[model samples]
Target chain A: MLNYIWIGLILIGLFVAVGNDIIDEVQNPYRNGEPFVSTVLLKKAPSGIRQTWEGDLVAPPDYFNGFYGTQRTQEPIRQPAVISKSADGTASLTMNITDASPAWWREMAKSAGSKERLLGRVVEFSVSEDQTSARVQVVFESIRFVKLKAVTQAALDYAAIAVNIALGLIGIMALWLGMMKVAEEAGLLQVLTRILTPVTKRLFPDVPPDHPAVGAIIMNIAANMLGLSNAATPLGLKAMEELNKLNPKVGTATNAMVTFLAINTGGLILLPATAIAVRAAAGSSNPGIIIGTSIVGAGCATIAGIAASKLLQRLPRYKKAMEV
Target chain B: MGEFLKNLVEVISFIAIPLMFLLFLGWGLIKKVKVYEVFVEGAKDGFNVAIRIIPYLVAMLAAIGIFRASGAMELLITVLAPVTGLIGMPPETLPMALMRPLSGSGSLGIMTELMKVHGPDSLIGIMASTMYGSSETTFYVLAVYFGTVSIKNTRHAVPTGIIADVAGMLAAVWIVNLLFR
Candidate 1:
């Protein structure tokens, strides 16, 4: 299943990227080689014989929407731009895309070879009588294969991010592992495990309820319920290690491990802190309104996950996977 | 009642770690367990464990990142929308449900965007936030936890995770529509 899903993601991603690129190629939505005729309000006239100009690229909202074939922007375009003339008199326009730039241009600029700037050929430029405004027709740089470029970049970036996430875990993992070690050595874990044996005995009947794995599992679940994910992860990993100690087949998951994981993934938290915070940040009047709903959702997930894990472990295939 | 519950949990969250540290170490001290040496002995394995899971994490995350960046999720949403719409789920929040199990940050981004577009108290926003809270990032959890123990050929974990995620998402949509609609 994991093999199929992993490969499925990659295959689907690549196929969709190629498909979108093909559609973009046929559509030519970026209007490659087509001139964008607009007016520019100059900040100041170029001094002396130097043929460089800097100003605001102005376009009415209707014209901009019509040009882009969408109504993504409601306001007029007043993006800052610069047109530079070479010694031989050929001119080019460069617009640095900022937050003020229209969303379409930003999307185009991001897909451009440059990350946040749009480069274009300034085909025609004429100064107004007042020397404060000019008419310009620019052919913006072509954007192609945007999704493919992003997919390639994401593959590389996420690999590095994965390494960073693992490395970041070292400190917390060490802290919790060390504390749990001391607790284990002190015989503290057994006392807790004993108190919870009746409950865990049913959940993980294969393992002795008094085992240290039970202790770590309890700690992990408790921390998770409290929404302390930082603490929960190391503790969960510790539980896995202890559970693996009981695995007859080293590379295969045991029934107890699967059950424990089902509970972890259920994500039954007392308070969904991140969601509430985001709601509050989004100016919600009742950010806490979903607390009950989240609990209900997660509770169902937890119960369903445990039931599924228990039922699935009885299947012949999963049972065979446990064969040493 | 909700406010009280929220406050109580907030206070507990603040104090839980410090209290655990004190209690664990304090108990170890009274038991004459050589707490420092024992802790250092256990801490020695942390670096190895962290390094050991790099490959698995990279494989899982890169696949998900590619799926996200390719805009396949949007296409998936379009396909799944009508089917899900019949179940009382807003088509817009479908991304939240789908992304929830795949990537944590990605789902958060979707939830935030949904809230921005629709006020956070609206049905879509409520459903999206509930979806975010409903389930863990199952793939990530599986990768890190199983990676730690070098478990491959995950027999039923994937299906189990999918079942849980589906149930959670459905529950989220059901309850949100019931209460918020």
Candidate 2:
């Protein structure tokens, strides 16, 4: 099943990318003009009064010399403008430029790797537009074709994703799983499972009362709830091994194992530490805001998982296996 | 109230780390379970697990990248936008939702990209983060767990897991709209 899915994804992706590329090629408006942003208007607020100045670049400046309109002369194209706030601070200065040339409206686009130009241009502005100073803003109105190159690049970028994950998981998995090992040996898992036994017993009827697998199942769920994913896997695997001991059929998953897998896959995270970190890295103001939502969503998912597994196990096809 | 809750959460996190460490060490000592050695024993298994899932990880990640690049994802979102929009899920988040169950890194990458495009404080960004945390990588978990035990006939697990994923996505949309909107 996984094999077919993998192949299907790859084939579908190729077909779609090719079809989109052809359409973009035929429909792209920017194909006729070199994407450029040669003219920039610098607006400065000196005192309460707002002043506007036109900053002109050398006409037909070398586009290949480097971005920011920096020609081969290596001289700065536009001199630095100083800005100061008014004493009253009620007035705001803004640039109002009306040039429809797409070149004048070029915006920075993110590209993969060091050569960001592979997809598009990311011009580094050398202007002093600090917040403390007069707020400097760029106003250019131009249009460009949708960035299609990135789609192709991002497809092959998966290898890098795999490599990055492979490298990162080493330390993370080691530390968390090691802590879990200590916790397990110290009987912390047993303590947790004891607390969750009533719920587990209700969830897994096939597992006999007083069975060790019940404790293991509860431990797995508890680890996941604490956002201890590293520990959850080992405990989940351990639980599966225990449940398998009771399975009459070796290769086929038993009812208990399926139920456990469903719950495990549904997620039981109380705190999503990793997602918060990602948001923080992305410079979010409130990285922790998702915590409440995550808990609620995971709870709903877990309920759905349990309900589905219970309903599915009662089906006629599975009834014979249950009777056995 | 939100500010107070945030601070309380911060305090719990600050305390939780050290508390967990002490709990393990003190409990291990009381149980006489050679905490250091047991830790090493478990830590060693990490390398084995990482190595074991390398193929699965690489295969899934590669497929995800191709799928995203192929414009198929864009098409999928476009096709499903009306339905998802009616449910308050932005079209941009469809990739993350679809990919969340298949691959962990895949969904994480999509979520990161989405957050980058939309400021993390934006409604879309909050929704993505909530979705990211609310569901497990169902297919990846299934592969690793069942592969470890060589379970060939995984009956009913896939459908159950997918149902859970749908429930998770819905809950994420509803909850984020309630809390952050």
TM-scores of the candidates in the order shown: 0.98, 0.66
Q: Where does candidate 2 stray beyond 4 Å? A: A1-4, A24-188, A208-217, A229-252, A274-289, A316-324, B1-5, B14-18, B34-44, B92-96, B102-126, B176-181
Query: What overall lDDT, based on C-alpha atoms, would model 1 receive against the true structure?
Result: 0.93
Model 1 over residues B1-181: C-alpha lDDT tens digits?
9999999998999999999999899999999999999999999888988988999999999999999999899899888888986899888988888999999999999999999999998899999999999999999999999999999978899999999999999999999888877
Q: Which residue pairs clash within candidate 2?
A: A17-B70, A36-A103, A37-A103
Candidate 1: how close is chain B to the reference, as a TM-score? 0.98
Per-residue accuracy of model 2 over B1-181 as CA lDDT, tens digit each:
6557656655665566568778878888898998888888877866665555556556666776777666686688778888987888888888889889977877899899999999899999999999999999997787667654567677777778889999999999998888777
Across residues A122-230, which tens digit of lDDT does each residue of candidate 2 receive?
A: 1322334552222233221222223345555665576677666555666756765677778777777667767777877788777874666776677677678777675
Predicted complex 2: CAPRI docking category: acceptable
Candidate 1 similarity to native, TM-score: 0.98
All candidates' chain B TM-scores are 0.98, 0.73
lDDT of 2 at A162: 60
Candidate 2 residue-wise lDDT at B153: 70
Q: Please provide, for model 1 over A1-324, each residue's C-alpha lDDT reduced to its tens digit, 9 standing for 90 to 100.
A: 999999999999999999999998998888888899999999867788887899999999998878877786899889999998998888999999999999989999889979889999989999999889999999999899999999999999999999999999999999999999999999999999999988999999999888899999999999999999999999999999999999988988899988999999999999899999999999999898888999999999999999999999999999888888
